[model samples]
Target: MIDFGFTLSKSSTVDLNKIDHSRYDQLVKLVPTARMCMNCGSCGATCTVSEYKGMSVRKVLYGIQRGEDVKAMLSSCMLCGKCTMVCPRGINTRNLILNLCKLYD
Candidate 1:
């Protein structure tokens, strides 16, 4: 058996650092759905792209909180709207992701 470890390159590290927590304010500022994510995996659970592209919808917000670049998840989104429908808070994840895409991409 071989144990393989993961290595994040220098550029990736830079992207992680590029996350500015201040952007979260925009979520509350521009959209009411922004602050609604309760860190529930429901968004991640319902995300269509997660299975294919390895994007964690919940982590994107968390990453943003930690000042990490979640911009990667912005484009991989499938825009299925399932997350929004399933959300207990009724957060419009589809729209939130779209707005985040503007900043991510």
Candidate 2:
């Protein structure tokens, strides 16, 4: 058997039905604005931490929905409120981030 230069990468598929969503549901209840996000890059673009640390509010929100641990990512957030100012949906992103952090505590 001949080996190819590279083998197939591990599956990146996420089985939404199998992943736990209780945490995300709780977040939405605490911060209703969590549901208003449209995954627009605006929040990430305006994030101060994102400029150097690659911290993205959009990814963090998605991570919560996927049941992935995002505490470390959330820690990088400076709560500067730039994301809140730029959100087209008018979501209070600072409040949402605060609430998301509280969900773990």
Candidate 3:
């Protein structure tokens, strides 16, 4: 057998039942528009910082749901409203981000 310099990475599977969903639930309650996101990636595509720094609203939303600390990521957002403009579902992404910030604050 040939020796490889690298090894397989650990599983990235998330156990949803084990994670706390209170934050996400509270966000949805605060901003009902958040519940309508379908992860279409349009927001990310139009996001001003996404191409330069990988900032993405979708990722923030996912991070909230997964119980991950996303304050650093959210800090990169400029609140430009470009994401909201391109969203197919008419989700107010800028407002969502604002509410997320408040939720985390």
lDDT of each: 0.73, 0.85, 0.85
Question: What are the TM-scores, per candidate, against the unseen true structure?
Answer: 0.73, 0.84, 0.85
- Deviating ranges (above 4 Å) for candidate 2: 1-10
Q: List clashing residue pairs in candidate 1.
A: none
Q: Which ten contiguous residues of candidate 3 have the minimum total lDDT?
A: 96-105
Which regions in candidate 1 have their CA more than 4 angstroms from the true location? 1-19
Candidate 2 TM-score, C-alpha based: 0.84
Root-mean-square deviation of each candidate, in angstroms?
4.6, 2.9, 2.3
**Cα error of candidate 2 at position 19, Å:** 1.0
Residue-level lDDT of model 2, residues 23-76, one tens digit each, is 889988888888888998899988898866677778888888888778887889
Error of 1 at 40 (Å): 1.6
Residue pairs with colliding backbones in model 3 are none
Which candidate wins on TM-score? 3
TM accuracy, model 1: 0.73
Score residue 27 of candidate 3 by CA lDDT.
84
Ranking by lDDT: 2, 3, 1
> For candidate 3, what is the TM-score?
0.85
